[model samples]
Target: MHRGFFGLLALGLTFAVPAAAADNLKITGDETVVTIETDDGVVDITRQKTEAALIGGVLQPMVPVPGVTPVGELEVLDALKTKSAKVVDMRTLEWRTKSTIPGSIHIPYTEVAMRLNELGCSGSQGAWDCANADKMIAFCNGPACPQSPTAIKAMAREGYPPEKIFYYRGGMQDWVVLGLTVAEDMF
Candidate 1:
């Protein structure tokens, strides 16, 4: 029994290590940076790790809403590349003016629900009908920032379909640390 158990454990580790390596997003090596063209200009997106402060404000929950899917850099990038969903910057204009994901749109947490029509929903400010809302990926400052979470929760409460929402919890913090493309002038 013990020998069989040890054998299984070794096999599991063997597979696990390779899988982990394949999925590793760690920033290393001298040639790891990448670049992408944006509306503003060509920007370098790096996988080079930095010691800069990347997170601030109050931390938010992992899953902001029960049915909303949480995503990371790769997922967010794929969506932007494919144009499969709208990437929204939930931070206020002040925060957005500093820097933001290249292709994302602005919709402050305070105004998201009131502006549901922009996401394909209809009705009015108080009466939202979001049955036909578009697929959206929401993000803000960073893990500690509550803007995205606040916007996501409000969106859910306002009857926006949770299944259609994707939360990028790392927000701008992770985006910058990872050396991803950011648009400085969002106006």
Candidate 2:
């Protein structure tokens, strides 16, 4: 390998290190060891961990958006079968044109708050009348997607019923990954 590659590897990635909070970190090892107090417990960051942190950051997992339930493919499948739920797409215009969940309504994340009336979500005089719809599920790309979460939050802020709103976190990525049927967006 070229010497430049080694030099590039040695370049450290920056991470936001918060000051010691209510949690106390106990350091027992040498200068190389870094102890961080997490909710689980104090974890030691060794040389290996430091490298990993640079690549992946503090090793945190995907957390669901607050005030919304994270659902998977099977759950969405059941929802579709029940015919009581209304699955909405929160992706962009370009991405939505490629593919989307079959029978899902297209309401981009950016328009969620404004389009609530068009969805007839009980607040405005929309022709759709969401009152007849059981659960209004929203989804985007996948678990890492922020569109659906942001839309769901917008709905909540608009006083949409928490019980009626659901978040399908798996989204189109998981839907395609699991070989589920997809509908090409005609709109």
Candidate 1 lDDT over 1-187, as tens digits, reads: 4555347556674222223333333333333335678654665543322355454344467888899999999999998999889999999898899999998999999998789999999998768999899999999987767788888888888899999999998889889988888899786
| lDDT string, candidate 2, 132-169, tens digits | 43567788877546677778777767766666777776
Q: Whole-model Cα lDDT per candidate?
A: 0.80, 0.64
Task: Give the Å error, residue 160, model 2.
Answer: 0.5
Question: In model 1, what lDDT does residue 162 have?
Answer: 93
Give the winner by TM-score: 1
Position 75, candidate 2: lDDT: 74
Clashes of each: 2, 0
